[model samples]
Target: MIRITDNEFDKLASYIQANYGIFLKKEKQALVTGRLQAELVQNGFKNFSEYFEYILADTSGSAVTAMINKITTNHTFFMRESEHFDFFQSEVLPFLHSTVRNNDLRIWSAGCSSGEEPYTLAMILDEYFGNEKGTWDTKVLATDISTKVLDTAKSGIYSNDKVGTMPTHFRAKYFRRMDEKSSVIHDKIRNEVIFGKFNLMEERFPFKKKFHVIFCRNVMIYFDEKTKTELVNKFYDFLEPGGYLFIGHSESLNRETTRFSYVKPALYRKK
Candidate 1:
């Protein structure tokens, strides 16, 4: 494997942090080297610095996309964090059903990787609304920074092991066995999710309407405190009053500094 020099690593790390809000520490050098080694060889680069320079000059920006797909960790599986979904089904959906004035419901799965999270949400919404689903708008906007993952997410296919953790009923109802080892989301459920490529580092949000619920779980673990704080605050603004934000269990927000009300671990509500 081609070794990444300290200078080259620093430059690449800084670029990723600045553009993606991901904090790549010194300890991650081995990870960077491993993930990028193939790309370096495939692109005919003799050294990390040369590859870095090529990335900076690639006007098509596909190089950046490819780099990010390797750099960003996208290891999510169906219902990986089950508690959030439980809370959503038991508490959030009930509240929305009772209080939301119009039939329009908006939920966002930011950094939705490989389709699992958003697909899970879509299934929950389908169950919650049941026959009333036709009366309400219940689609979710799923976005991620990696085009590669977005493509996978759009296809909504998962290996059996990946889908194994899903609840029995959810698996039975929403997914169709594509083969011996893979399952694909049902068309009706799949249609409820719209996937897009989005970078969290963008200063301004472009949404015309605020979300009723935002599932940004596990996505911010890669971000530094400053980046996470800024991004959380942006989430606050984009959420409807009383809207809920579900983050990863490992993450936290300082209640003293933010407008969101702490509902539980990894869960908050815009007050």
Candidate 2:
């Protein structure tokens, strides 16, 4: 493995924090080394310094994209944190359906990893709206920083075990068996989610419409206290009044610092 120097580590860590809002501490150096060792070896780079320059000088942005992909972990499965989905189906959906005059149910699956969360939400939306689904704009916007994961998400394919934990009825209705080992999400659910590469650190979000719900679960754990506060505020701004935010259960907001009202564990409201 190509060893990283203290100075080289500092430079790379600063760059990641500034550009991606991902805070890497000194203790995580081993993690950085482990994740990025293959990239350096594959490219014939002798050290982190060379790799850093390679990323900085690449104007097409693929180099840095690849760097982030290696350093970030994207572990997720369908119906993760099941209670949030239950709340969405039982309370949020019914409220939005009745109150949203435009019949446009805007939902976002921010930091959606490998497509499971957004696809799961799409299935729920399909089941909830049923016959009236055609009349409503129920599209879900799913975004992630890694292009590799975005590509996987866009393909809408998954191993059978990945979708296996889901309830039997959902597994039967939403997935089409391609082989014994894998299944593909039916186009009905796949089409409802629009996948894109997005970096949450961007100063401004590009959307014109505020969302009715934002599911940014487990993504903020990488950020520091300041970064998390800023990102949470950004979420608050992009959501409509009475909108709901679902975060990782392990994460909590400082009630003193945040504008969002506490609703339950890992859930908040924009009112």
Candidate 3:
């Protein structure tokens, strides 16, 4: 593997942070180099610095997209964080039931890697609505920066180990056996999620309608304080006044920086 020099590491890390707000700390040098090696070699680059310049010169932005896809971590699975789903069902949905007009619920799973979180949400929505599902528009807008994971999310196929973490009833209800080792999400649940490629660092969010709930869990951990603050405020603006925002249990919002009212650890509400 080609070794990444400090200068090369700084350049790539700075570019990724500036463009995507994903803070690659100094300690991640080996990780960055290792993950990017195959891409660098496949593109005919012998060194990190050369590949860095080529990425910058590629004006179409596809190179950077591919770079991020290679470098970003997208390790997530079904029901990875069960408590948030429980809260979404018990507290958030009831509020929406009383307040939402047209029986329409717009939820976004930002950084929805490989579909588990949004798929889980979709299943909960399916179960919540039951026979009345057809009468409501409850589609989930699931987005991730990586096209690789978005493709996986769209396909809705997973190893048995990943999807098996959910309840037995849920497993039986929403998934079909693909083989001895994997399963595919049922089309009924699969169609409820709309996956797209999104960059959270965009200067402006492009959505005509605001969301009732936004699940941006575990994503902001990569961001610096300023970037996380800006993104949280953007999420606040895009969420309805009373909507909820769920972050990873390990992540938190500073009371001094955000308008979101802290409801619990890693959970907040716009007021």
- Predicted structure with the largest TM-score when compared to the true one: 2
Q: Which residue runs does candidate 3 get wrong by more than 4 Å?
A: none
Better of 1 and 2 by TM-score: 2
To one decimal, what is the Cα RMSD in angstroms of model 1 from the true structure? 1.0
lDDT of 2 at 44: 93
Alpha carbon lDDT at 207, candidate 1:
96
How well is each residue in 28-98 modelled by candidate 1, as lDDT tens digits?
99999999999999989999999989999999999999999998898888888788899899989999999
lDDT tens string, model 3, 1-271?
8999999999889989998999999999999988998988899898998999999899998898889888899988788778899999988988897899898899999999999999999999999888988989999999999999999999999999987798999999999999999999999999999999999999999999999999999999999999999999999999999999999988999988689999999999999
The residue pairs in collision within model 2 are none
Give the distance in Å from residue 97's predicted Cα in candidate 1 to where it truly belongs. 0.9
Q: Write model 2 residue lDDT over 108-176, tens digit each, in one string.
A: 999998999999999999999999999999999999999989999999899999989899999999899
In candidate 3, how many Å is residue 117 off? 0.2
